[model samples]
Target: MNRFDRFLAIDWSGAMGERQRGIQIAYLDIEAGTGPVLMRLPDAKNWGRVVIKNLLMKLARADRRTLVGLDFCFSVPWPEEGPLPEGEAPLDRVEELWDLVENICSGEAHYYAGPAIRSMESAFAPYILCDRYRGDEFRFDRFRETESQLSPKPASIYHCMGAKQIGPGSFAGMRMFHALRAVNDHRIAIWPFDPIEDANVVLCEMYPSLFYQMAGLKRAYDHETIQNTLAYFHSGSPPRMSIQDEADAVISVAALRALAADPTLFSDPRRVAAAQREGWIFGLAPS
Candidate 1:
């Protein structure tokens, strides 16, 4: 297995407007002794998707072996009922899904305000409902198999509304994935879809909540909690953090550090089958 030299954790957002405050980027160098540091956009309050895409392209050009963790559902649950429309092929592969989402949801964010997803005359239409989001009614990917067992179960990627909802973020994330793939010409290796191989940049789906649980910490944007979590990951003593800081990013980078130390995390036997189609979270145990 190729060891990553750098780990990046991105806390994503799908809200309207030119910029989103919910977006946060954090990274750590395996050779660095200190904890992860937050990245700031120049003269901007928040990061736009384009800016992030450019940054990643630069990283790839630099020949850096980086593992990027974006906090969003990489793909939705495959339709369980029947075959899709004749031309609308099943999303059995991640690249195929990315192309589909980019083609359908181009030029707008939040999937062009849900109507685009609702109007999608394809097999995935049922799962992206703006209202009435239920995961049990629909089966998610293999990575989400343990979702119900965990506290604060994750909302379905189709659920686009409400504070705890994840649908909007996922829709926006798919758009980003599409853009990144175009810029890189499909050179980026998205885990499960393509083997790790000798790819310079590897992208994976991430759930910050799982990292918090692993670190034995509660969900709060406080200095002490961030410090404690960093301490748990051997990031040395945590640096001072503000309540306004994006604490999830810090915790996520620390979690990536832990994951990088263990090769078994990436070599799970179950990943061979389910991950190729359904997608999987980076550090989640097999269900």
Candidate 2:
């Protein structure tokens, strides 16, 4: 259980655009202990899904032991009773779902998952909530088993409420992860799906709210509160962090560093069998 050298936190977005302004990536070097700086694309462009993949590849090549936490679910739920094709059985693994989404969204630009979401609505609708449509099995309070284990209880990825929609990001993220893994160059390993032993880079699901709670930031929007959160992780605060997303990215990485220091962290995953397809949030035990 060696520690990762670098920790990165991705404040991801699932917006419809070539580059989403909401997307942000921040990193900290455990050894350097100086920064958790926000990353930007060249020419001041916004961060896009494709750009994120490229960055992961570059990090993998560098061979630094890195831990990346994407602010999205790595996988979705697979209920015992849900929509599926006429002959196909329920998906048993996250890797397969990643490929399925990628193939479905091949025509989608920037790995946006709009097309896939529409095309596969029937199969996943039972879990996802929409304004006009809710699957036969859909329940407003329904969420994956892993999500229910959190303290405050996270919003369901199945829920499509604006400002709370996290499902779309998972679809797009799976596509990104699939592309990174499909290269066969072995640039990355998706945690729990792939073992962490000696891997140069590993990515996992992250929820900033969990880190916020852990950092004792009772008020995330307050300037002093955000600074205190950063200070808790030994970041001591940086500049230009007036927005919530910026704080999320910076605080996330710093928290990740502090959390990773606990060698026993995530050593035993709860509900292991189910977490195989419904990925667990980082720093939480699957339930």
Best by TM-score: 2
Q: Clashing residue pairs, candidate 2?
A: none
Pick out the ten consecutive residues of candidate 2 with the lowest summed lDDT. Answer: 81-90
Per-residue C-alpha lDDT of model 2 across residues 67-141, encoded as one tens digit per residue? 998999887665665324444456656777788778777788888886545444445654556665665655666
Put down candidate 1 lDDT per residue, 1-287, tens digits, no spaces.
43888988888877765577788888888777677888887695788666777777777776668889998877765435322333455555666777776776676653332433455443456544455443233334322443444566777665555687776667677777777777764447777566675777888888888877777877777767777777777776544455333788878888887786677666672354545566678887665
Q: Report lDDT (CA) for all predictions.
A: 0.68, 0.75
Question: Which segments of candidate 1 are over 4 A away from where they belong?
Answer: 79-89, 109-125, 128-152, 184-187, 237-245, 269-272
The TM-scores, one per candidate, come to 0.83, 0.90
Give Cα distance to truth, residue 41, candidate 1, Å: 1.8
Which segments of model 2 are wrong by more than 4 Å? 80-88, 119-122, 285-287
Q: Largest lDDT belongs to which candidate?
A: 2
